[model samples]
Structure formats: structure tokens, C-alpha cells
Target: MPDLPPIVDLRQSPTALRVQRGVMRFLRAAHGFSCFAEVSLANGRRADVLGIGPKGEIWIVEIKSSLTDYQVDRKWPEYKEFCDRFFFAKPPELDPDIFPPEEGLMVGDGHDAAILRMAPDGPLPPARRRAMLLKLARLGADRVHTLMDPGEPL
Candidate 1:
């Protein structure tokens, strides 16, 4: 397979961007999951990283670059509706104890990450799952389309 092109995400902070990259890398390499970043959800909230496993299990990872970001953002709970599992990924130096125990946790650098605390399974409703599957498919297709033909509007 050809190597993926480097795409810069202007919306993320340096620390947040690193956390997002490492989380995406870990999901793909360790769990055979296809991941996308800055995903728009049904609830009007954007997800930091959204992934679908080989078995079609959906996961949403919320990245926290600093303690302030985590504390200021109370919308993470809303993300649970769109995924089978949810996680908070951050730099290894950050204290994991600040995160809620019910959700998953990950710690690493920009290179790679590990799922230090596994999240509980919260299966989505059948209708919602079907909708999200469609959303993911369309998002993936749009990305490919844009990557292949930059002049075309997605």
C-alpha cells in the first residue's frame, strides 16, 4: 500500500493534535480500526477521533491536551449516543485520575498510544447504529473523493 499523505489539522492545539494522532495510530495498529478525526456528530458536537473496528464496533475518543480543556468541556457524555464505546486520550504526563472511571483512558505521545483503561460497552440502538454506519461510510467516501480530486467539492 502507498503511504498516506500528511494532512495538517489547523483546528487542534499542538498538544491536542498530538493526542489525536497517537490515539488514531493506536486504534488502527493495535485494534484494526479505521479512524477519522474531527468528526461531526448528530448532536452538533464534534468528536476528536471516531473509529470503527474490523468487527464494526464504533468508538469515539475525546482528546484533552490540558486540564482546562477537559474541565471546560462537559459535552463528552453526549458523544456516548453515537458510539459503542467512548474514551479520553491525553499525554502520558497528565493525571488519569481526573477522568471519570466509567469511560476509557489512554496515554502516550504523538507517535503511539495505549488504552490504559478500557471503557464499558454501551451498545447503540439499532436505528442509531444504522445511521452512524451510513454517516461513517459517507464521511470516508467524501474524504477519499477529496483526496483523489482536490478540485471537486465534497
Candidate 2:
């Protein structure tokens, strides 16, 4: 078996910090977005950085210091339901093929950040898209477990 790469703790690694800085800079320059670091979602899931794109598209970025951390989290599916775009950030050495080819955005360079949008092709109905956007807006504005308790709106 091929030897697995050693995982590094992001909280303590300079490379992880640089990747984070690159992600922040990329978001700022590409989308004029304000990165909400470690924002708690209604489901008690915290995203590394949530950015609102210029077109009102919601982006959820999950940053991992190591490939192993990314593999173990397994929460990207939940994030997809909440945001229009879902991204995974880590060092470039991590293979993007590890992510689901149809549903994940890979973001990072060994020294900077790069992103690939993996949204499916074809257009959603305007009404459905608008409704989803509204839900995202509400979720971003306040915290409520609408996703959990379907009867409640926050």
C-alpha cells in the first residue's frame, strides 16, 4: 500500500496558516467578500469561512490543515444543502480526486489558494433558486434550527 501522508495540526502549522491567508485573500480579491471565520450554523456545524458572492451566491468553505482532517470530517454534504457553493481548502499536495468529483470545490495551493466550483450543470427553477437564496439569507442573518425542526422559522 502507498504510504499515507502525515497529517499536521492546522492550529500550529505555518503552512496551514499560509493557506488560510491565501483563502482569505482570494475571497477578498475575487469576490469582495468578508470572510466569516468559524461561523456557527443552525445545525451546530461551524464553517471555516462563509462568503457571500457578488451575485448573492452563498459559499461555504471548510479549511483543513491536513488531508486526513478533510477526509474525516464528512460534513460536506450537509454544507451543500445550506450553501450554493461548497469548497474544501487544504494544501495542494492533497489530491482533489479524493473529493466527490461531482459535488465539491477544491481550494488551495501549497502556498496560496485556488478554487474549483463543482456545482452541477443545468439551471434550477427560478422560484426554487429564489427560495433557497432566501433561506440562506435568513440563515446567515440569524440562528435557528429550521433544517432540524421543519415547523420552525428563525
Candidate 3:
């Protein structure tokens, strides 16, 4: 048998992981979006949850595990430049009103989430949308290829 390279182990805080799961469940089960976690936007900021809908609309969700988490993350606003809609997903215990009124709200547990309000659409420019969709396709293909061939070079 040939020797194989070690697999990378991505770690996340338990709280963050739970929130991610909840956000993903909500995006998939409720919104019919295909989601990817920890996706890097062209601006170099990472989105906690990036969802692509059937009609090519892009949504970015910033997950806040605690009050402090929400307070300290100032870069979430920049995510709007890259996506059509933006939202904040947090534990059900947090008050949805605490977030910005113009943005969307989602309350989630470890398994699911409920949308308290709908996000307003801010459609992306055609060029940016095309670029983003290409990036997403490449990322998806890379992930699938890696799973199929563990030693494949990215």
C-alpha cells in the first residue's frame, strides 16, 4: 500500500459548531439554500454561513454564539457587499430585536432555527454574482474531489 498524506482536522469551538449546525439546518430546511460554512469572500473576510439559493441569490449569515460574540464582530456589515442578503443567526435565547432592524433575524437551537423576520433583497451586480458563483462552484468541486481522492492536490 502507498503512504498517504495526513488529513487536515478543522476545529471549531463547541458553541460555534452548534451554532453553525443550527444555521445550516435553517438555511437548508427552511430556505432551500445550498450552504457552505467558513467561506471567504473576495474582500478577504470570512462568512460564517454563505447560502446560495435556487435563483442564484446569495445570503450570508453571521452566527453569534453569545452577546460578546455579536458585539465584537464588526466585519459582518462588510459581508453585505458580497451577498444579496445578510442575516444574523443566534441561539433562541437571544432577543431578535437586539440585532439591527434593517437586517434579517434568525433564532436557532442546536438542530434548527426559525426566521423571525425576512431579509430585504439587495441584488448583487451581474459581474459580482458571476464571480461569486464561479468561486462557489470551484469550492464545491474541490471538496468533492478531495473526498474522492484524499491525496489529490488542490
Candidate 4:
């Protein structure tokens, strides 16, 4: 096998550090409304941030430094199964619309930070939605292993 490049530490890059700090600050502000950060899903997928609104709406926020990161990842669809609302966080220059139209909300910075809610023109059937939600709930509750363990009969 060929050698791979070493991982670059964002801490050493001023630009990356600034963006990281911005994301942290945004998450902190969200915490005031009962939102929290770094919530882990049962499948080992850690959402960058998660928050529940007073009315019980679940929000999932995924942060990216650039549009390319948003485009290449496959996890966003999986994230949709878990939350009623979803958001992508990036700098003001990045256009959130680059993502699929049906996926989720787009939150960008301008003035003091603003959000645009993107609705899926065609939604999944209610039954399918419920199934996905249940799967995600189990994952979040750390019960996925029970379902996946080979020792247990299906």
C-alpha cells in the first residue's frame, strides 16, 4: 500500500480555527433555547449539533467549511431520518442551495445570522417517514446494537 498524507490539524490553521470558533459560538447561542451540540447517533454518527425547540421540533445542524464538503458526503440523508428539521452551517460566501432541494434547512450568516427553510417538494409516505424516525430514535437511544447483533435471531 502507498503512504497517505498526514491529517492536517485545523488548530494550526488560523482560517480553520476562526471558522471552528464561529461554529462553536453559533452552537452556544442555540443552547440558550434548549439546543445542544455533539449529539451522538446510535450508529456512530455524531451530529455536529442538535437542538429541540420548545414545541418539540428536533433540529439537526451539520457544519461544513466549504460547499465541496457538503456535496460529497452521504450522511445528510441519514440525518434526515432523525430530525424534523435540518440545517447546514457554513460561512456567508457559501450558497447552501448547492445541496439537494429536498434535504433540509439552510442556515447562513449575514447581519446576525439568518435561516432559510427548504421544503421537499415531494415527501416520503407517512409510513416510511415513521419507520425512518423509529430507526433513528433507536439509534439515538443506543439500541441499534441489539438489532444488529448476529447472536440474536432476526
Candidate with best lDDT: 1
- Angstrom error at residue 78, model 1: 0.4
Cα displacement (angstroms), candidate 3, residue 94, comes to: 2.4
lDDT of 3 by residue, 67-134 (tens): 88788878888899889999888887766767899999887778988787778999999999999999
Quote the positional error of residue 118 for candidate 3 in Å. Answer: 1.4
Best-to-worst order by TM-score is 1, 3, 2, 4
Model 3 global lDDT (CA atoms, 0 to 1): 0.81
Evaluated with TM-score, which candidate comes out highest?
1
Q: RMSD in Å for candidate 3, one decimal?
A: 3.3
RMSD of each: 3.7, 10.8, 3.3, 9.5
Looking at candidate 2, what is the lDDT of residue 132?
54
Better of 1 and 3 by lDDT: 1
Residues 5-107, model 1: lDDT tens digits: 2234477888888888888888999999999988898899988899999988999999998889889998889999999999999898889989998789998
Segments of candidate 4 deviating more than 4 angstroms? 1-32, 109-111, 118-154
Task: Quote each prediction's TM-score.
Answer: 0.91, 0.63, 0.87, 0.54
Q: Show the lowest summed lDDT stretch of 10 residues, model 2.
A: 1-10
Which lDDT values do the candidates have, in the order given? 0.87, 0.62, 0.81, 0.53
Give the range of the ten consecutive residues with the poorest summed lDDT in model 3: 1-10
lDDT of 4 by residue, 1-154 (tens): 3222122223223433344345445544754434434556656776765655454456677766576676787876676666666766666666766866655544544323344555343344577556645654554444344434525443
